[model samples]
Target chain A: MIQVIAFYLFATLTIAAGALTILARNPVHSVLWLIVAFFNAAGLMVLAGAEFIAMLLVIVYVGAVAVLFLFVVMMLDIDFAELRAGFVKNFPLGLLLAIVLVCELVLGIGAERAGGIQLGTPDGTAATAAGASNIEAIGALLYSKYLFLFEAAGIILLVAMIGAIVLTHRQRGGVRGQNISRQVARRPEDATVNMQPEVGKGVQL
Target chain B: MTEFFQTIGMTYEWAWFVATICGILLIALPLMLAVAMIIYVDRKIWAAMALRRGPNVVGPFGLLQSFADGLKVFLQETIIPSAANKGLFLIAPIITFTVALLAWAVIPFNSGAILADINVGLLYVLAISSLGVYGTVIAGWASNSKYPFFSAMRASAQMISYEVSIGFILICVVLWAGSFNMGEIVEAQKSHVWIINGFVANPLLFPMWVMFLISGMAETQRAPFDLTEAESELVAGYQTEYSSMSFALYWLGEYANVLLMCALNATLFFGGYLPPLDIPVLYLVPGWLWLFAKIFFFFFVFSWVKATVPRYRYDQLMRLGWKVFLPVSLGFVVVVSGYLMYTGHFA
Candidate 1:
């Protein structure tokens, strides 16, 4: 009964917040609503017994991604009218994308309801061993069964990151930056001098 | 606790719900009280370092100073700026205070004494702590002011920079402990090296502990790294435009975060609830006392640093977090994991 209530609560809030993410006037509010949607989606994952995935969802999406979203959105000097001006121009493309997404969702759910397509027969070897926690089970599978695929995914992410950096990074001339190592390595004697001079005599450089 | 509630003739679900509420109260009420007293202690530490008395009039040795200040703030009218995003402005402080308290649920005060003994306890802490940035970010934006906005920008950037290194540092601990469960992490440290009751005793882990301590300080926005509230630069930072109870909540929330960081330091490195030595005779004392002692010790270290160290330049802070701490911690993660694998520790 509690699970039922929790499921409904999370489901409702997820939908509502997701809708608000698009509907909100302020970009900052939109980002915050998106975060709320992410949180509720994490809750749904938890209810599905994917606690590890749920935590990663919260940590990665809500924590890091949404924060960056909010950071960018908050800084934007938004013109609401200008934003709305593009909406009509973009409507056909948006509608096309939404229809495609809805079609994919319907097909996916229909496939699941029609019984999952079997690529291979399930072997007990891949099943989560009894008494193992979700994390352990996932770890076992990830490290043993899907190690190459996992590493490939990591490599893909790394390549994407480097690509982004390369695309955005530029060198500007005449910009003097701090040489922290040089500063640290400098001795007092190297930067200073002690001298005794007679009256009206200046210390030599 | 659920069983205790069940004795009163409630159904299992109701009993569980009531027990959870009771548990929350148990942790939160004392946490509130602790935050208040910690403020006084922080002042005294700062005062002693500066050769002055701190908050001596409100109560004996200024024991009631925080309470008196709380009362004053409570009595003051909440002043909302006409230009501020009013709803968000008010919600910001509550978010700070609540998120500060939320992570405590996963912290094991003693053996089997955790409120939420979830498998991914440490991850839960990470997730909740990450949420803390939103309070400052929202407050800064909602204030609709210059300084606060700058402070908020600094805060968001600073927090994100430090969190990267902090995450890597925590990974080293998690690798060494072989568990993401907070309770298990603490348990794994028992007699970790010979008679030592902490991972800190290990030569490799000691450096990680030091890095964790410093990163923890930065993560909590404690002094030396408190660029968000560097008054000489940004007034009170995100709280510059806040007034009344809202301001007080920031105060309470900041100290609470400090305490939480101190507790994390204790738990992660100093063998939370475990005596420094693993002698059987030492186990006679209650675990919670040992935890409290470790927490107080770490808190003193925090306060001492706050008193003695000067604040960092913003660029320098970023440099340390990224150019220094991040690479070192990431390297340590590899080194620690390799050592664990080589030693067959997981086996």
Candidate 2:
């Protein structure tokens, strides 16, 4: 009974938050609303007994991705009036896309009703062992059956990260970067030259 | 608990609810008291280190000092900036305070005495700790002030930077332990199945512990990694615009997080509620006392570090988290997992 209540609550909240994410005037509030949607969706996942996925959703999307959104949205000096100016111009195209997407979703649901799709359910061999926890179950499949695919996914992420770093990195001639090794290696004897004739002259530049 | 409640002429669901609320009060009340006492202790130790008297007049050797400070802060009027986002400004500290306490639900206080003995306890801790940054970030942004905004930006970046290294370090420990369950992790330390108990039993894990310690410090935003609240730089960082109980909440939450890190240090590496050695005689003493002793020891170590180390420069801090700790922790994760695989530990 509690589970049913929780499911409905999360489902309602998730939908409401999703609507708010688009309807909110401020981009910052929109991003925050998106985070709320993600959180409620995670709650839904938890209710579905996918604890690992639920935690991952919270950790990855709400924790990291939404924080990035908040960071960017907070820093931006965007004019909301100017943003809304394009709404009517793009409304027809957006409406068409939305209708097509909704049709596809309806078709997908109809197809699913006709012939149910076992989404995210692991294969027989890699199925969760009896009494094993959710994490262990996922790991057993991920590490063994889908190892190569997982590795490929990791490599793709690595390449993307490298690309981002390389694209953002800049080398400026006048910019001074610290050389900690040389800094630590410096001794009073080497950096400070002591001479009796130093009194006659100020110091070496 | 539900059965107990049912036996007592209550409905099962209500019994569960009552049990949960009771459990919360059980942990929270003691935790609040610990915070109070620890604050006094922190002041005393820092004062002694700096050759100062600290607070001696409040109570017997400043026993009531924290309570006095809390009362004083509570009495002060909450000062919200005229231009501030009032709702978010109010919500930020509450978020921080709540998130800090929420992580404690999964922490194994003494054996199976945790509130929620879930499978992915460590993940829950990580998720909740990550949310802690949001409070500071929200507070900073909502203040509608320059220093606070800069503080929030610094805080978010610093937290994310260190979380990477911290994640890798946790992976190393998790790989060694072979489980993410807090109780199981502690049980692994008892040295039952493996050649030795605990990851620290192997010399390779020593460096990982060191890295975990440093990363834990950085993770909690304590000194010298407390760039978020660097008074000399950003003027109390995110809390610059906060006053009264809101500021108090941040203070309490920050300390609670520091204490949680200390507790994690004990639970993950130092055998948690277990005795230092696996001797039979030491089992006579209560486990909670052992846990308490370990927590206090780690807390002292935290205070000691704060007194000794100077705050890191902003660039230097970033360099350490990304260039140094990240690679080192990542390398250790690989090494630990590989070693485990080679030894047929997993198989």
Candidate 3:
């Protein structure tokens, strides 16, 4: 009964926050609402007994992704009037996309209600133990059955990161950046000269 | 707590509700008092290290200084700038304080004595501590000022930068312990060897302990890494615009965070709530006392570092975090994992 109450509360808030994420005028507020939605969805995942995944969701989305969103959004100097000017112009396309998305979701759910495609056949070799925690189950599967796929996914991410860096990175020829190690390694004698000269005579270079 | 409540004549749900409330008070009230005492201790340490007499006015040896400051701050008006986002400005400090306290829920005070004995306790701590940056970031934006905004930028960037190395360092510990549970991490350190009490493993070469300590200092925005609030430059960083209890909340929250880092250092690298040595005779003293002693020792180290080390330049700080700490910690992660697997530690 308590779980039911908690589930409903999470569900209500998730829906409310999702709605507000779109309806909010301020971009910052919208991002915050989206974060709230993510948090509530994580709570819902927790209610569904996917505690590890729920934490990952909160950790990845709310902690990193939404923070980036907030960082970018706060720095933006968006003119609401100018932004609104494009709303009507893009309304038809947006509406069409929304409708198509809704249709896809509906059809997906309907197909699942009908003879749904089973993602995989039950393999006794990789079966999760009854009492194992979600993390344990995930680790078991991820480290064994899906290990290659996981490695491939990791490689793909690595490639993408490298590609992004390669694509954007540029060298400005004359810009001086601090070489901290060089500074630390410098000895006083190397950087300066202590010389004695006759009185009233300047030290030779 | 629920059982205790039931013995006092209450239904199960009511008992549970009462127990939770009581638990919150038990942690929070004491934490507040600790923060007050810790402030005095920090000042004294900082002063002593600087070869100066610290607070010697209020209560014996200025022990009540924090309380006096708190009362004064409490009496002052919560002045909101007309240009500032009032709601967010007010909510920011509350978020900071609450998030600061929330991470303590998973911290094992003694064996099985945590408020929440969740399996992913360390991950929860990471996630909550990450959320702490938001308070400062939001405060900076909400304040509608440039200095505060710049401070906020520096703070968030510095925080996120250090968190990467901190994450990898924690992964090394987690890999060493073979568990995410804080209690298990402590127990894993109970090997008969005194040197192996920490997850450091191979003390001379394995530098994860020092890395974790440095990262913890950076994560807490302490001196040397305290570029965010460098007074000469940013004029108190994200805190410049804040006043009254709002400002006081930030102060409390920042110290609370500093204390939390100290606790983490104790829990992760030192024997948390466990005695320094594994001698059975030493177990006579309570676990919580040991935890407190370790916490105080680490706090003194924090203050000592603050006194000794000069603040790093902003770019130098970034270079240390990204260029230096990240690679070293990441390399150590791979090394530790490889060594563990080779030794069949998992087996």
**Top model number, TM-score:** 1
- Rank all candidate structures by their DockQ, best first, as comma-separated numbers: 1, 2, 3
Worst 10 residues of 1 chain B by lDDT: B158-167
- Which has the better lDDT: candidate 2, or candidate 3? 2
| Backbone clash count for every predicted candidate, in the order shown | 0, 1, 0
Q: Which pairs clash inside model 3?
A: none
Q: For model 1, how does the per-residue alpha-carbon lDDT over B98-187 read when each residue is reduced to its tens digit?
A: 999999998899999999999999899999999999999999999999999999899888888888888888888898898999999999
Alpha-carbon RMSD to native, per candidate:
2.4, 2.7, 2.9
True contacts kept of each: 0.74, 0.63, 0.41
The DockQ values of the predictions, listed in order, are: 0.79, 0.71, 0.57
* Alpha-carbon runs more than 4 Å astray in model 2: A119-129, A193-205, B192-197
Ranking by lDDT: 1, 2, 3
Please give the lDDT score at residue B162 for candidate 1: 83
> For model 2, how does the per-residue alpha-carbon lDDT over B1-347 read when each residue is reduced to its tens digit?
56788799987777887888889999998999999999999998899899999999998998999999999999999999999989889999999999889988987877788888878888888888888889999999999999999999998998888888888888877887788888888888886335344556667777878888888888889999998889888888999999999999999999999999989888888888887777778878888888899899999999999998999999998998899998888888788888889999888
Error of 3 at B192 (Å): 5.9
For each candidate in the order shown, give its overall lDDT on alpha carbons: 0.91, 0.87, 0.85
Alpha-carbon TM-score of each model against the true structure = 0.97, 0.94, 0.94
List model 3 lDDT by residue over B122-190, tens digit each. Answer: 888888888888899999989999889998888888888888888888888888777888998888887
Over A1-205, each residue of candidate 2 has an lDDT whose tens digit, in order, gives 6767888999999999999999988787788889889989988877766778888998899889999989999999998687888887899999999999999999998976665765444422323467898898888899999999999999999999999999999889987889988999999988886656555686545
- Name model 3 segments beyond 4 Å from true: A111-128, B6-14, B192-196, B200-206
